[model samples]
Structures are given as C-alpha cells and as structure tokens.
Target: MRWNNATTGRWTHRLIPNLTPWLQRRHGQVDFYLTQMISGHGCFKEYLHRFKHEPNPYCDHCGTGSIEDAEHALFICPLFVRYRAEAETTTVCNLTADNVMSCTLESQSKWDAIANMAAGILKELRRRERSRRIQS
Candidate 1:
C-alpha cells in the first residue's frame, strides 16, 4: 500500500529518525538501500505485491510464510544470519528483531554497520532472486 505524505512523515521521523541525515552522508548503493527503506520498496514482498511480481507476499526465502519486508531481511532472515550477528556486535547493545524498526543507533560506527548490512541484504536478495529467475 502506498503511504500518503502525512503517514510517511510520521513513519520516517518516529520509527527511523536518523534516516534523512544518514542518507545525506551516503551515496551509490548505500543511498539506494536507504531510499528503498524509506520508500518501502526494493526486493521486499509488499513492494513486489504492488507491481505483481509475485502472487503472494509471503517470504519465500525464509520458508516461514512471513512477509519479507526490510525488517525481516535485516533482523530475521536466516540467509543473512552471519551479517545480523555482526551487526548486533558492532552496535553498543545487542540488536534484536524489533530494534531494526524501533531503536535508534546513536553512533556513526553502529549506523555504518547496519547501513552496510542493509545494502548487503539487498544485494544478496537481488542476486538470489536473479539466479532463481535464470534457473526457472
């Protein structure tokens, strides 16, 4: 579902407050990832649904029948287990599934770690999905 301007405003400021400044300092692929997150698209299930890329919004990658949004990719996808663990350690405190959307990282190092992982997650997912398309 496309969010109206008012809703988007609240979501960005409340749930992901540091996103605008973070995007300002990044470019290329990292910028792309942050843009995708902010806009709620890019290889994620709900985005795919809007364009009808796939019939169902459930996450096929994890085989758990969950919606494969950015949150799932960052904090819960088994495919990125190692990266998630690393992201957790790089931050001041352990990162949890909910923290991806709720908590704010107050340090550049922590933000960088998560930002890198976010981009990597998109890269990996795009690669896998591309390969799946090729194979089929």
Candidate 2:
C-alpha cells in the first residue's frame, strides 16, 4: 500500500511495534526537531515562514500551489520525480490523493522499501539545495 500521510502514521505505529523503546533510544532535541520536521510542525520560524509565502509555497516540481507541507516535500515534489525515474525500481509512488483510501495497499516490506527510497530522495534534494546555496 502507498504510505500517504494518514496511513504513514498508522504504518509507523504498526511497524515500530515498540515505540517507547525506539523513542528512548533516540531521545534528544535532534529527534524532537526531526519529528516536527517530518510531521510538518517544526517550531522553526524560517520553516514556518516558507508556508506563509504568497505563491502558497507549493513545490517547484509538483506545482501543487498549496502550503509546502511535509507531505509535499517528501512526496509531491517534481524534483523527486526525476530522482525516482533515475533510480527506477527503488522509487515509491507519492500519494497525491486527499485521503488514505486512495493509497495502494502493499506488503509491509514493500512499504518499508518505498519509505527508505523516499527518505533518500528527500536527502538528495536537500543536498542539491545546499550545493546551490554554496554556489550562489
């Protein structure tokens, strides 16, 4: 199944099985910030400001024209589309649907694989952005 936002949380809960231990092992401010960043609710002022911009902060790739939420960053970005194409067979389909019902149901392993691919794509995008900033 596709791991859209709603189902992604549920999938995380199901897969982790032992949230307390995981949290304890990773306990730190960095973990907290990462959680917020992944969930689209980090308290960072600059991050928040990005969503409030006039063009709606939609992804440059997908052109969703809405708040550049976490879902958009991870899934809807057009840049990721190219990344996925290049990495064929390792890419997960980003659910652009409004609800979880639209997500394709897949095995747990498949979902995990896709999630990992998504993470890698996001990391690459960040790396590209950093390189661009350094170049400018």
Candidate 3:
C-alpha cells in the first residue's frame, strides 16, 4: 500500500495480516512505538519532522539513502551493527522453535534496550549537527 503527501512524498508497505504481530515479535514493542513516533501517524508528520535527520532519511549508519522506514530502523541500520552481531550470535544458540518462542515472549525488555540505544544514537547525531552549525 502507498500513501502520498505533498511534503513527504509516497509511503509503501506490504499488505499482510501478520505484519504487525511479526514486527512486535521481531523488533519488540518499544521499537514499534519509536517507529510510530518517528513516522508521525499518532501526531502530525510536520510536527515529527524535527526529529528526523537530513540527507534522504536513510539508515544513519549504513547510508542506504532512502526513506527511513521501520525495517531499516530495526534490522538494517549500520549504527546497530553490534546489536545485529549479538543477535546473530544468539541465533546460533536459539535456533530451535521453543527458543524462538521464548525470545518472542520475552521481547519487551530486549526492545526497550534497543529503543534506548537508538534514542542515544539519535541524540548524538543531533548533537553533531549542533556542533557542525556552531563550527560553521
């Protein structure tokens, strides 16, 4: 599905019933909330625009240079390379159905940690912008 706006252009997503549950399971509830906050659906996009960094809204770390969407925020961001690496390591041990289910069931704390980390990274990025502005 796609939604078009005069300012932000187009947004797209998969039309699947399981998408939300899958997101909550994989990324955790805090990440989901942060995604909603950033996307400005609960509020106005214009109001939320201040939170976004410039240069095409891509993954802050990877520089994928596209719209900064939820998937990129959760999985693909190069800034969270350490988190991804940890997840990869955990995946080896937690490769069973029971372990996967346990992880999903206990995802809230994990999500909180990730969300906090992301918030810190974003704050640092904004701080860098402030520094650059001062320098210039």
Taking the tens digit of each residue's C-alpha lDDT, what string does model 3 give over 66-129?
3444444334556546654554454433222123323444455544544454455445444655
Writing each residue's lDDT as its tens digit, candidate 2 over 1-136 gives: 4444455664344334444443444222323323543444542222555665222344445555544455555455565565444333432443432321112123344334444545565566466556645776
TM-score of each: 0.71, 0.41, 0.37
TM-score-based ranking:
1, 2, 3
Ranking by lDDT: 1, 2, 3
Question: Weakest 10 consecutive residues, lDDT, candidate 3?
Answer: 9-18
TM-score of 1: 0.71
On a 0 to 100 scale, what is the lDDT of residue 86 in model 3? 59
Query: For each candidate, how many residue pairs have backbone atoms clashing (under 3 Å)?
Result: 0, 4, 0
Global fold similarity of model 3 (TM-score): 0.37
Candidate 1's clash total is 0
Summarize candidate 1's per-residue lDDT along 69-105 as a digit string, tens digits.
7667766778788877777787755665436533334
Of 1 and 2, the candidate ranking higher by TM-score = 1
1 or 3, which is superior by lDDT? 1
Once all C-alphas are superposed, what RMSD does model 3 give against the true structure?
Answer: 8.3
